[model samples]
Target: MSTTTAPPQPALPIRGFAEFLGTALLVIAGVGTAVAAPDTGTLGIAMAFGLALLVLAYTLGPVSGCHVNPAVTLGLLVARRIEPAAAGVYVVAQLLGGLAGAGVVLAFRSGDPSFDLSADGLGANGWGAASTGGYGLSSAIVVELVLTALLVLVVLSATARQSNAAVAGLPIGFTLVVAHLVAIPVDGTSVNPARSFGPAVLTGGTALEQLWVFIVVPLVGGVLGALVYRVLRGSDSDAASQDTPDPTTRAGS
Candidate 1:
């Protein structure tokens, strides 16, 4: 008699590639809209990020869980939903994708004589002079910390049960929309480190100078959010029981 072995999920590289493509598309749509349509104001920009993420959640939810954000990867890592190696791969891919996406935006914007990387700057996240609302550093930190926590909590909670998978993207995406709506004025709404990395690097100056805040703060928020999820959902016993990630509920951030 032969016993059957369950099949493993897709290879890490495949998942990493999906993350890369997803992140790139997200930046292209979200950042592109923000830069090109500044006249449309905050509502339009928030919707762009939210809608792009909503679509990516469904399209790439199965392949590699569609993290697309370093903060999200960190959140899953804290929740024990993903391994360290896998999370590292996801972060690296997301960073590269963000850079590529910024490049695409730059290419398009360059076509117009009025466009200037230094003057106009990429849609990079920052506070003080870099902030659209002229918010200070303290304000920036507080908003990022609180909003990132909420975003990560939503990601973990919405994807916790298998039954939630079919409809998880809606809440997840809406959470992002709400996050942006509230925080955009504070620091350009960088709950995701990968989303900030690309434009900041390309734009340089203050965005680059304050890059560490965006990267470090959101990751801390991810961990905090995971801890909150554990407490609210009866602790780690449930998540720890399954040594491997559950395929039914594909986790995305």
Candidate 2:
């Protein structure tokens, strides 16, 4: 008799590359729209992000779960959906991807002689006078925290075992769109730290100064969202127990 083993899974590096590409693509479409077409208004900007994520979710979801956001990765980590090492790699990949995406936007803008990085604001998130609506730091933090928490909750719920896997991207994308609609005027809507980091780094000055708000708040929100989901849906151990075969039935067999 002859037996064959299953093929090995893709290495972490390969998966991380997928994350990098997915996030880079996301920033390109999202930030690109904001830069190239400012008159598209709030709905268009929201659609840009939503559509980009929806496409990437299907494109790279199988390879890397299509996180593309550090907050999402952190949420999955707290939910025990991913290992610590893998989570760290994913976050690093996302940050690098964000930078690359911002660079792409900068390159594209360079073609326009009128474009100025400092005055134009490369869609970087900010607050107070920097904010589009003049929202203060406290408002920015609260909005980011609540919006990110909701976003993570949607991510967790959409990817749950009981969810409709075939259509998970729709809900996830819609959640992001709704988040943008609510938070864009307030702080350009940075539910993902990596998303904010790229533009802020490139723009510098006020954006960079306020960067900490986006980073710290979204992370806290991600963890809180995961904990809330775990509380309401029961722990992973509970799911495992439910899946385990009853000893009495096994013994009867």
Evaluated with lDDT, which candidate comes out highest? 1
For all candidates in order, the CA lDDT equals: 0.83, 0.80
Write the residue-wise lDDT of candidate 2 on 1-253 in tens digits.
Answer: 1132223446789878988898888889998998899899999999999989998887777677788999888887777777789889988999999989999988998799999998897989998889889899899989999988888888877666422456878888988899999999999999998888899999999999999998999999998887888887886624522332210000000
Instruction: Give each model a TM-score.
Output: 0.93, 0.90
- Poorest lDDT segment (10 consecutive residues) of candidate 1: 240-249
Residue-by-residue lDDT tens digits, candidate 1, 188-220: 998888889999999999889999999999989
Q: Lowest summed lDDT over 10 consecutive residues: which window, candidate 2?
A: 244-253
User: Which stretches in model 1 have alpha-carbon errors above 4 Å?
Assistant: 1-7, 236-249
| Model 1's TM-score against the true structure | 0.93
lDDT of 1: 0.83
RMSD of each: 3.2, 7.4
- Clash pairs, candidate 2, are none
